[model samples]
Target: MKKTAYITGGSKGIGLGIAEALLKDGVNVAITARTQNDLNEAEKHLKTIGDAEVLVIKSDVRNLADEENAIQQVVDKWGQLDYCIANAGVGKFSSIDEMSEEDWNAVIDINVTGVFNTVKSAIPALKKSKGYIFTIASLAGTNYFEKGAAYNASKFAIVGFSQAIMLDLRSYDIKVTTIMPGSVATYFNGHTPTAADAWKIQPEDIGQMVVDLVHMNPRTLPSKVEVRPAVPPSARK
Candidate 1:
């Protein structure tokens, strides 16, 4: 049977790219997002790619119940899950003094809590299959910059959480990895991915890395991967 993967925020961006790559490799994929329209559109695009089974679920990952339901939906359809990608995250840029509590909460709730819920809900099935768990974090998880107080905090928390889980799940032969990407050309931050952004990494590049990692020897685990653009645009003096 083909391996099954559950990817949160798979309706677009890096999540969608990974799903597409896995589909081409004959892996079944279940994708979740908050919007039904987005899921529907993603399903259509996934179909064009390959023969892999594609399941779409509408879910808001911040809600524990929703995350559980999404995982259950995948298990019901696919029977087992071999991979879990907690890629759903949100970001807001603001100085610490100007950041509102609501903004901070929103970032934390979606980035930190959402990842927690995704992993918690999928752990049972993952333990059963001895599967792999990959978290889509940011370079901010380790590096900080201005106007990134809330976003940085959330990502930093994710790195620590992911590393701890890696240790916790190692006994089960379940691998855990945190992928921290610096800059990617995607429809993130209200900007659409474009050729002009070729200098930055592409979503598919990350997808390919996931595929490679999955195919590695079981005894080897690359716990952390930090990726960045080879060259970044600089302001003219």
Candidate 2:
């Protein structure tokens, strides 16, 4: 039987990296993004990487209705949902005083409430499949830094949220894990990946981490994974 996964914010970067890895393993994948063009491009590229059927949906994680409809469409097509990944997130770096209400809401809405919406919508199908849930958190979630107030708060909330849900879903044979990564090379925060970023953790590294999680023995559940580069930024100097 073929596995099926649904990922949010999968147009590019880490989410796309995960999608590519899953597709390479012949897992039917449905990826969601807020824009139609990004989904279109992702679908085209994803087709070339793997033979698994690809579904691209334009949906915003911040919108509960959109999240529900997207997951419903995936189940409607595949008849089952094995994994739901909440990889959609946003970051706005500014001092507490400099940040506007609009910016704060954007980060919190997409990072915290967005995961809530995705998981809530996916639970019915996930329960049926006894599926897995993966939340792409960050090292920032645990280690707070200056100017990271909003992003840190949101990710911190998700870390606690993921672990709590793990306990809740375990009785039904569902597994949940939050992956916290440090300094990954990706097009995040309006910066593009370049050769200088070779020292950082590559997005595909996290992708492979997800693949490994599924391959683990069913009796064993690793609830939280913290990944970082072999060398820190300071060490590179």
Best by TM-score: 2
lDDT of 1 by residue, 129-215 (tens): 999999999999999999999999999999999999999999998999999998888888799877888888888999999999999
Which 10 consecutive positions of candidate 2 have the poorest summed lDDT? 228-237
Which pairs of residues collide in candidate 2?
none
Residue pairs clashing, model 1: none
Candidate 2 C-alpha lDDT tens digits along 1-237: 899999999999999999999998889999999989999999999999877899999999999999999999999999999999999998899999899999999999999999999999999999999999999999998999999999999999999999999999999999999999999888889989999999899878888989999989999998999999999778876
Error of 1 at 43 (Å): 0.7
TM-score, candidate 2, is: 0.98
